[model samples]
Target: MKRDRDLVARVLAAKRDPRCADDLVRDYLPFIKAETAKFMGRSPQQGRDDELGIAMFAFHEAVLSYDRARGAFLAFASMSMRHRLLDFARRERRHADVISLDERRPDGGEGDERALVETIASERDELDERQMREASRQEIAQFAAELESFGLTFLDVSENCPKQQRTLEACQRVLDCARKNPELLDRLLQTKKLPMAELARGAGVERKTIERHRRYLVAVLLAFTNGFEIIRGHLRRIVPAGGDGR
Candidate 1:
């Protein structure tokens, strides 16, 4: 009971700090490998096998999604990994079907099959687009759930978000400060609320402005802090002052 309680606390901590998530996953590497080996019928090589990579991604997803309501963390993670393994199998089978087009056929000439493969590839653009869409959907769903914990939603965020360029830049200062000092985020996670006074001071934004746009700040902060990968993919386009926006 005590060990399970500690793990639950650790998972909640991971939800607050991205680095905590990394460390938690590192500690569970043996368990993750065991799960991958179960699916693979042999031990998965750490860097060489795709199965290990998929299992790690699944474990990360479990970290992001697990709550006390979900019961034990490992059981939840095991299920997530199993589902991903099944998805990987399906994707591999589809890839095999497409790649087999390059195999020598007794009747069909190489030029004829090559042309067919090209036409099909152009039409489907198959692999990358489909994978990206699926990944984006999952990220959006998880982000939405996280936002809800703070009594915010996508529509609420959209309506409350700052419209003016200057106001937007002020909000950016808050983000910059949080990036430098992650304690604000840790407080938000612990209390399920933002530290407005300290945040405003750190970012040099007026406290009134922070109050005016609390939900927007919360949404953006949560997205950037946690591992909402696909949803926060636009971070590259947001450049800093006098920087290359990298």
Candidate 2:
């Protein structure tokens, strides 16, 4: 684990220096290939496949954008590669066509094709719903564990969350402060406490307001700093892209 972190730090440093970029890419070529192969269901050819090219570019982007707050660098890089491959497939219309209901039955009988179609659709819906529920459950479990590290629980977050728009905005201000200042987040993680004074001063919000929403602010800050994707996705509607806490 320490080794991976060291390598990620090195790659990030290399990203900032043009002279080291090529070496960084060369060293991590296997990683790029593995990520691509995971998505493609087959080992990607280094120089023969377009997906490899896209993965290489995505890996480069990951090195450039990765931060300590965003969790493991390899996980981020894999996600970046997967998303790029998915987007490329979408643009190229690479998805397989649906099987035709009119095709001859494998049973060598005049099967009820319409019934088969309905059954397939119903099963697909059930499977999709099950997968989504499982994913949500896992995300919540992981989030709860993260919250525990800061002496918090899901119940605490729910009960302490601000209800009024004004208070909520104030909490968002604290979150923005933490997000903008990595040092603040590092301090919070190191001390296992919210930097209320720092956050209030940096966000230009009243100290009293920061104290009142301390729990909520801590939860929100942890979500951003830990790269809680599901939580962040859910908050997208509440938080503005400009980070104004609106």
Candidate 3:
């Protein structure tokens, strides 16, 4: 537990100081390889495999985007690497639009004399969709687990969410304030409590209102700050593009 906190602190510091990025990556190479190897079902060799390079980049990204609220840094980096490798595999599987008409058949028979495009089906889409659904399920499960630390759950967040448009807008404003103010977010994560007074002041919303929608606001803000891309993508409809708090 202490080690995880220390690592997260180092990652946060590295994000502010560009010079530390390389050292950070170097120190975590073994971890990166472990994550990549787990996803690939084999160990990746440095400077010899493309997957290692992708995992390194993903780890760097995780460093930049990680928030302690999202749980352990290693877990976050592992998920990032997994998703990146999956994406790479999908790209590699993509077939060319046109193939030789006289290409030999897979059955070692005579030439088909037909474009490979004709034999292609919608299997790719279905496969991609299945992968996406599985990824989403994993993300939600991780999110729910993190929410447990705050004495909240997915059900709590859903049930506590503001019902009215005006109330929802108020909660969104609070979330916007947290997103723009790193100090506010840091305080929330550090204390495991929301800074209602600071949030109300920064968001220009009433303190009582902020208190009322505290759980919902925390859930939304955590999604944005924690680099939960899947969860955040689903929240686009509720929260506007910019941090205007509208």
Q: Pick the candidate with the highest lDDT.
A: 3
Instruction: Tell me, by TM-score, which candidate is best.
Output: 3
Model 3 C-alpha lDDT versus the unseen true structure: 0.78
lDDT of 3 at 231: 84
Tens digits of lDDT, candidate 2, 1-246: 568657766877877896676778788898888877766769988669899999999888877877766655665566567667766865454222245544443444566334344455555567556544544565577668778877888788788888999887777666776777777776776677888888889888898888777777777776666545656788877765434322
The list of candidate 3 runs beyond 4 A from truth reads 1-5, 12-20, 41-49, 64-76, 95-115, 119-121, 242-246
TM-score of 1: 0.61
User: Residues 94-123, candidate 1, lDDT per residue (tens digit)?
Assistant: 675676565543336655434445444544
- Ranking by lDDT, best first? 3, 1, 2
Residue-pair clashes per candidate, as listed? Answer: 0, 0, 0
RMSD of each: 8.4, 5.4, 4.2
Provide the overall lDDT of each model, using Cα atoms, as 2-decimal numbers.
0.74, 0.70, 0.78
Error of 2 at 183 (Å): 3.3
Candidate 3 lDDT tens digits, 123-164: 567767777877777678778877888999988898988999
Judged by whole-model lDDT over C-alpha atoms, candidate 2 comes out at: 0.70
Please give the range of 10 consecutive residues that has the lowest summed lDDT in model 2.
93-102
